[model samples]
Target: MRALKLVGKTLNFEVESLGIIEWYIHAIISYQIINYEVLPADTKTPIEVIIDQLSSLSLSIDSKNLVSKNYFQKMKEDKLRKIYPYFLKMLNNPSLSLSLSLSLSLSSLQTIKIIIILDIQIFIKLMKYLKI
Candidate 1:
């Protein structure tokens, strides 16, 4: 949870984007979850642990795929591929979706927008066949 505590000090750091902070938080939590916990963090153990701990507010296909790929490597040592399927099953929960959908709708906090946040100007020559 040391990484989670750094949320307050994020502005103090020289990071490029909020995503960098987010990545660290997720990485730390993933490291923890792989170590085995005592009780149900969610209705299913690790799934709830993941969403609550990692703030996985949404579960897009890419999000699910990315998470699976990440854990796949760690779980490979145990050769217990079953955990991946269990994780996916929890992500598929309809109730979980309903609850997760209630998450705060704050404006994105990305520290860098468009890398340089520039205003680009475009000049166009009129085309004969194009409508004005």
Candidate 2:
């Protein structure tokens, strides 16, 4: 989790355009951020606060809802989908974190599919949510 904080901080730097790498990073970090188990949220835990801010979810999962891990993943997807704009716009970053880089670098045989066949000029302008 601490490592995630560092990567998150590093990715926070301003970048005009993001690539597939950034998508993987944000997906992983946002996944961890959204799904990391913490307080019950009655006290409004930091994770819950972040989640609520991200996807407007209360994120107070009870024992009754703990049917299976897939259930959580499925539910998380709905919330995660709401949050990620190609990658969760994590504090305005939406870019690569370390763990994701490690995974991509460590693996070679993974088959890839890029569904978004975007025009070059429009791609750079899409991910950066900047005032300038």
Candidate 3:
């Protein structure tokens, strides 16, 4: 979660385009929410604030800026790998899992499926740890 905040903050300063920053922020918030169970209480509040801001943005603008290809790749390699344990926690909550599945981009979903196939042992370990 801290890493996410750092990424968000860094992108906020480094990216000149509002559209790109907004897109990245939205992706970060979505990823955080999907893995909420592992986050600390203090971290949750800031993420909620970001979500509120995200909600206020025009949907048309968001759609126009939503380029999931590069963002999804970065998320998978950087954020997702770092939070795989929390992602497994997400599976324990049926509601969260359902929402996450529903919210994911098609490419992101495909990436996850491929990861699971390639890292079956890690997936098995996570499931076992959760006693699922």
Candidate 3 per-residue C-alpha lDDT over 1-132 given as tens digits, one digit per residue, 9 for 90 to 100: 354344435434221111112224445446556545344323333433333433443322164564433333343233433433322323333332121121223454342221111134544453454344
* Candidate 2 per-residue C-alpha lDDT over 1-132 given as tens digits, one digit per residue, 9 for 90 to 100: 344334335545322323223223334445445545221222223444444444432122442232332333454544544433323334444332322211122247663333333344433343342111
- Cα lDDT tens digits for candidate 1, 1-132: 344225324423222211211123244245336533322323334543443432343322343333543443343322232233324433454343221111222346522122111112210111111122
Clashes of each: 0, 0, 0
How high is each candidate's TM-score? 0.21, 0.20, 0.19
RMSD to the hidden true structure, all candidates: 15.8, 13.2, 18.2
Alpha-carbon RMSD, candidate 1: 15.8
Model 1 regions more than 4 Å off: 1-93, 100-132
* Native-to-model Cα distance after best TM-score fit, residue 120 in candidate 3, in Å: 0.2
- How does model 2 score by TM-score? 0.20
Candidate 2 residue 125 C-alpha distance from true site, Å: 18
Q: Give lDDT for model 3.
A: 0.35
Indicate whether candidate 1 or candidate 2 has the larger lDDT: 2
The alpha-carbon lDDT assigned to residue 1 of candidate 2 equals 31
